[model samples]
Target: MPKTKKLPLNSLEWHQHPKLTTLLSGDCHQLSTLPDLQFISFAQLQSILDSCPIPVVKRAKVDAYYLLAPMPILKQLLGHPDSHKLTASLNIYSEPEPTLSTLALIKPALFYQKYKRLPEILHSRLDKAKSMNLVTPNKNQISQLAQISPSAFRKITHSQGGSHG
Candidate 1:
């Protein structure tokens, strides 16, 4: 038998990682198959968010909009410094729009229920919130960030658009 090295949690490769791919393909169980994301950093989450286009949808009979992402990704968000303003739950539905994964409620609640229409500042705040030691970036994460070129980081930050905050 041969041993295979595990990918570092902070690796950008996670965007295409099999578990995420399976979740995107509608396999909810793959969520549990993912590694624990409790220690995932905000920057790492931003990278994943940049790579995966999680959708925002409104549930029938619900007055709030929900951000839908694979469970692992949601977990990372939950660890964010401002996560106290958010709520998350596993979604299980089979109609209107089938989605069986994690759903997050953005506090102060969004009244509009349009796809991908979340205010740009909302994302900017999440990405730029001062790290209040909520999730300490591990050595691997620090190393990963150090390895990225300044231009690459700028590209990642600017891809979504100018920071409104």
Candidate 2:
């Protein structure tokens, strides 16, 4: 057998590194190659949720949980309703810590069924939120106004050209 030289981590072909390729391919299912987007399995997400709490704002009427997600992910989640029961909004309850970005209101069953792994940046943000005690079980609830229906919110987002700061 021929030996292959190990490339430095800083190399342009870092993604081709044996260890990184294995790590990404092993646990996460790739969604895109250009940006290298991969989604971790639902079971893996569950394990992470068990340890590092992701603050969920529950909507009792719709039986959904509003979770903070990046804009790109939120857009993807909204586009595929059949895959996941989801509606998203740039508007979210005012919070002092862990500044809000985009919120995806998703049903638990559907969310688990169509689990798409959050990006590393979001995971790190969640970890930071957890470490700072910004997220807690009690604080997981949001106001009624924040629980707008999927269709209504979708219309609003669409009308606004789907861009929010």
Candidate 3:
């Protein structure tokens, strides 16, 4: 009797895709039946990602506003030579919208893709302050109004020295 030869491992492209990673990580129960995760190349991986719902939305909404980041951090990234040309339009503060300043929200995926640094979102922190109802110049007021922290707010101001330009 002839012995059977072992099959080579599936393609390596599966792990390279962020969308794929998010999907597989998100719903393992659905993928339990998958025999193997071999994709041929980046293009193939991209094709699969394109077909998926979450990845599709994620890629499409890379430019879409998902939530707000503090203004100072936005300004800091906008002013930096390395990051400036990548994105603009951070000047999203409304003068009539009360005391706390804020930039238009950006998705975490967009931030990671652009800057390679995961920006800290202050929503949770702000929420904490609000739950406590601590009314301080720094904490409760800004958190309640803008849902962002003073430190995150200061990042942009620190970069621009309070100049919104």
Candidate 4:
């Protein structure tokens, strides 16, 4: 069998995806022939680098990391109709470390805002989201969020307005 090529220096890369694994990473070994992008599940990825067999991560720097909230909590907030409940939920997550899990607990509106998605835009930032203070959680909202986990599902890999890297 043929051997796989290795990536060049500073070639290892990673990021958090909205779906599938909190983080997506790619190493230089996998980067030589493919697009220059690496992906992986955040927690598992961290565990690997911390105790690596071949020591793939050299001078490893956390490029982008997210503090997540549990899916259940996020679902509850997303389902809650009262602003007070939402705020309460947010507080629960805000204390200590705020994981992507906690962020997932929020509605997409606020979630986008904090992450820098402008509220006025199609995908506005959380800061620009429809005033959660004015809006109450509705049955439809809860129903809509019934089955999602509080973690990134998959990373969207693509070039500028095109396919993944």
Best by lDDT: 1
Whole-model lDDT values for every prediction: 0.38, 0.29, 0.29, 0.27
- Which should have the higher TM-score, number 2 or number 4? 2
Give me the overall lDDT of model 2.
Answer: 0.29
lDDT digits (tens) for residues 1-165 of candidate 2: 111222111221101223223333544443441221124333432343344333333334332334333223333322332324221222223341242222222333355433232222233444456799874322112111123222222212233332221
* Model 2 residue 5 lDDT score: 27
What would the per-residue lDDT of candidate 4 be over residues 27-61, giving only the tens digit for each residue?
12221222111222334233433342111111236
What TM-score would you give candidate 3 relative to the actual structure? 0.15
Q: What is every candidate's alpha-carbon RMSD to the true fold?
A: 15.1, 22.2, 22.8, 20.9
Worst 10 residues of 3 by lDDT: 7-16
Model 4: residues >4 Å from true position, as ranges?
A: 1-12, 17-97, 107-165
Residue pairs clashing in model 2 are none
Q: For candidate 3, lDDT tens digit of each residue in 29-83?
A: 4212212222123343334333321211111232332112222233222223333
Residue-pair clashes per candidate: 0, 0, 6, 42
Q: Model 1, 1-165: lDDT tens per residue?
A: 111222222321222223325545644432233344546555655566545443434444433333333334555554566445433232222221333233222411343333232334333333454354444454444334334322223212456553342
Clashes of 1: 0
Q: Return the clash pairs for model 1, or none.
A: none
User: Cα deviation of 63 in candidate 4 (Å)?
Assistant: 5.3
Judged by whole-model lDDT over C-alpha atoms, candidate 4 comes out at 0.27
